[model samples]
Target: MLAHHTLTGPEDAPVLVLGNALGTTTDLWSDFSLPFRLLRFDHRGHGLSPAIDGPCTIADLAGDVVELLDHLELRQVYYCGVSLGGMVGMWLAAHTDRISRLALVCTTAWVPDKGRLDERIAQLRSSGMESVADTIMSRWFTPLCPPDAVARFRAELLNVDLPTYLACVEAVREMDLRADLVKIDVPTVVIAAAQDHATPTELVRQTADELPDSELYVVGDAAHLAVVEAPRTISVILDDHFGNDLT
Candidate 1:
């Protein structure tokens, strides 16, 4: 069974479920939790969730998400997924109509570097989480941040499960939802970091083009981890876009 850590907020409050990039805990969405009922937890084998042996596919992650939503008894939710989390949301939305609104941040339908992703997963599984986490975390942002922010990010990422992290890498790499994007019939928002090394501005713009009522924002002076790097800006935009006030 997949057990999810849920944030209990106002019952009438609009549901906001958060999903993080692989290798990081729900802490990746800490900034969003303050103003909403955040459902933040480890994926099947990431963060506090126990690592289990199985074929971890993007479909598996999507299945886990369904189980979590059912566990929460939420019939509808606004899904907020970053990187790997975003891919999961895309998968979920493609398969069902449970997601009322979808917000994908700093993630792409596909991983730009497939070779490095495979190598990194192998390194994480064999060499352990600590061995490759530092190297991977360094890619989280560009070289334009204060030391403290970067240091904090590094610490959190290192705590992720090695095998689960690799599984997430495959999810990001293999996902291609351009065909499915047209079928997405929800209010979708795609936020991209202007200086992001992971998902470039152009790709985000391309993703936006495929959607119907999608809004795109380029958070200034931020990198791949833009939501954390600039929470206030992200929070305001989220509140305006996906929050209950908008509905």
Candidate 2:
């Protein structure tokens, strides 16, 4: 069974499955503060989930998500995925009938070619996460964000396991859901940090274009971690996407 963390809003509210980016935990979504039944799980090696030998593939990540859904006995869910989570969300919408709404944040439909992921994992494995975490937070932070935001991200990332960190990086390297984009048949929203160096705005726009029913929103005041740089903007985006509809 996938060891997971869950947050409650109302028992009757719609279930929202929240997944974080690589090398992070459910705490990344803690600021979301939505009024739905929020479910979060660490990838097999990242959080409370056991670090088992598994190839980091898109299918593998998607399978983990399915396993979580089955474990929770959730019939259908609204998905909120960032980076790795977004890749999994793409797969879920394409292959699963149970996803009612989909939201992709700071992610592209294709894998990142620069191998920044491999480098990141190697850094975590050898020198420890604190050093890499600093660099990552710098990349994720906007020019206007306070310096302390980076410190907070660094502190939280110190708890991640190195092997689990590598596993997720491999997953990110292998992901490419562009061909499967049009298979999505549900309401969808694509959000990008306009200043996102990790996932350029053009890539987000291209990814959004493939969806038959999707809207794109670019939050200009943020970098890769929009939830941190501008929480209220992210909140507004979610509010616009998911209003009074538990149906």
Candidate 3:
């Protein structure tokens, strides 16, 4: 099971589950605030979670989330994910009734850069996480990113298990969920980072357009890690989307 942290709320509060991006952990949402029971966890092979030795699919990762929720005895939750997390959220929201509402932040409907992902895989296999730290950080944040946040994310990257990290990279490399977007029936919010090079604005826009019941919000001046880079804006958007009495 994934390592999870729960924020206790009122007895009858709807659960809000937070999923981290590719290389980060639950700390990715350390600054987020909302009035619900918040559940945050490390994706498989990330943070304190058990590692996998080889490649896996986005559905494989999403299955881990299902197991996590079941293990926690949670019947339903409002879900949010960033980048890779968002991909998994899309899968869950489409394939199951567990996710009551979803907020996909800086995520895409498919892997648009297989060639780039191949290059990243080669670099990671050769020199480990440090090899692409600068490039990833550059795409992950805008110039407004603070040194401390960058440093913390850098540390998170460095701690990743190499095989497990590569497995997730492979998942991103193989992901193509465009055909599946139409199946998502729940209320969804697709958030884009204006400066995001990783997912790109157009890709996120298309994700919003494909979902039958989705709202689009773009945050200016942030990049791939919009939730971390523009916490207040992201938090407010999430509140407006998932904070209603939909539960």
Candidate 4:
């Protein structure tokens, strides 16, 4: 349980925890270059972290973060998460005071299509990750995305631990954070991909609308993995949101 993490940037800088999406490890944030201390980690069983045998909730995943912060002696930090990672960010901001600022990228407060998600989970369980890897990769990026980037992400998806991925998928399937948005009092930014079919722009908008204090930003020509497809745009948005208060 500590969740394998790499903390970089200035030692004395404000801590900014980066959460990874489902099927992704800390490498998902490899492109980021910001001022604050960046803490990136792999979810349980995803990378070097140990996986649990049974199912878990988003709060359970978020608790891993709390435990990681405690181990590092970090009291409060800016948090940014993509997809499943964003789900964790929402939970942390709503339930704990550890998060000072929040950025949710290409994520929703709840799964809008439970039937579809259930079907996907069933497919993965019955057929394996290979059977659904192409479909998942297709949704991660638009056709305009570079082939190299697509290949890289596809490989990352393939390398994920099947059991843990399913566990996280179950977490998403059972998750319902619509009511908790109001409790997240920190300055929050909800980033969406205009062409993202996984977590559409409207859903992201709804999440921002529910949050008591939040703003919405949509990145064009990108799909679910907008952070990878448009690293510069994502960087600028994050820097503007988190860099303003370095004190």
Highest TM-score model number = 4
What lDDT does the true structure give each of the candidates? 0.77, 0.80, 0.88, 0.92
lDDT of 4 by residue, 1-247 (tens): 7889999888989999999989988988888788888999999988788878889999999999999999999999999999999999999999999999999999999987999889989999999999998999889989998899888888888888898899999999999999999899999999999999999899899999999988899999799989888999999999999987774
Position 181, candidate 4: lDDT: 93
Mind giving the per-residue lDDT tens digits that candidate 1 earns over 177-237? Answer: 7777787889888999988876788888887888877889899888878877788888887
Give the clash total for candidate 4.
0
In terms of TM-score, how similar is model 3 to the real structure? 0.96
Q: What ranking emerges by lDDT with the best candidate at the front?
A: 4, 3, 2, 1
lDDT computed for candidate 3: 0.88
Instruction: Sort all candidates by TM-score, best to worst.
Output: 4, 3, 2, 1
How many residue pairs clash per model?
Answer: 0, 0, 0, 0
**Global Cα lDDT for candidate 2:** 0.80
Instruction: Give the TM-score comparing model 2 with the true structure, all chains together.
Output: 0.91
Best by lDDT: 4
lDDT of 3 by residue, 54-142 (tens): 67899999999898888889888999999999999999988889998999999998876699999999999888889899899998988
Candidate 2 per-residue lDDT, tens place, 41-152, comes to 7876666777766556878878888988888788889988887788889998999897989999999988556477777767777887777776777667876888676666
TM-score, predicted candidate 1 vs. hidden true structure: 0.90
TM-score for each of the candidates: 0.90, 0.91, 0.96, 0.98
